[model samples]
Target: MSYPNPNPYGPPPGQQPGYGYPQQQPPSPYGAYPGGGMMPGAPAPYPTVMPGGVKAARVMLFVLAGLNLIGLIFAVMGLGSVSKASKNASEYTTSDAMTAMNVGKGLLIAVIVVIVLFIGAAIMLGAQFGNGGSGVRVGTIIFGVANTLVSLLSFPFGLVHTVLGILIIVFVSKDDGTAWFNRPRY
Candidate 1:
């Protein structure tokens, strides 16, 4: 038969919960204590951190720029075609082409203006990637909304731009994007 321990109320001898023995600590109320552990609602401490999905936003801007470039090219080609046709019609037919020519000129100016505005906005949006302030984010969102609405005016021709603009708005407004913009810096 084995003998009973002298102190029954506590752990026996070296088996006590201290020194070399392991002991379970109570759950911390404040969460992670130190090191690289992340606390809930705490921003990441890494310097290379960026907003989520910013790449896609930048890509959208680049796509918009490409579309604007395409529009410029198309506008140039259409202008050339219209100019040649109008000149030929005026030379071949006695009917007055002045009104038609004036209308075509007006359309050309309008197309050029729209294309320039979009191209400029696209470049600005792309340039601000990873380096812009809160103002840039707000401005981009506004630009995207305005672009989408105006693009809708172009209907079938602008459907792609409208979709891209919508995507930009969504991506920029995401939690990661906001965190990146609002993250503290040195």
Candidate 2:
């Protein structure tokens, strides 16, 4: 079932070097061949090869981070919507209306605050990974979260603001030839 190498580059004695064949290495402490700590016939730890490609993993992380940011923005906007709905129901300022409006406003404000904090975190991470310290990632997150929340609760114009923030983060993050923090362009 096995054939001879017929050459030095070919398979070794009693073993082939191709598919399903085992590779040979030097021996050392801890074991016979040091590969598995067993005898000279032990096998190597399956190869410490990387699971997924680095580039692909990095890209996926960047994307998930971005999507999470967007989700945070949407959550904040939901708060404002609750507020507006409450306000509308209180046009006559009745006791029930007033209570509803207050609850809505409180929920809306709280959500907005939480969204702002999340956006801030994203901006910090983005800046750390992307452009230098001068990056407007933080500012963009703030403006985007705020504008989107307000727009959702008040008007439709806030969409533009949210989009702008996303654009800034994505574009700046993609820029190359810049320092890690705010150092030189190296």
lDDT of each: 0.78, 0.50
Scored against the true structure, residue 105 in model 2 reaches a CA lDDT of 69
| Model 2 score (lDDT) | 0.50
The sequence of per-residue lDDT tens digits that candidate 2 reaches over residues 43-88 is 4333222223322323433543466568667766776676667657
Clash pairs for candidate 1: none
Lowest lDDT block of 10, candidate 2:
46-55
Per model, state how many residue pairs clash: 0, 0
lDDT of 1 by residue, 57-128 (tens): 888898899988988998988888877777667455644576677588679878888888889988987788
> Which candidate wins on TM-score?
1
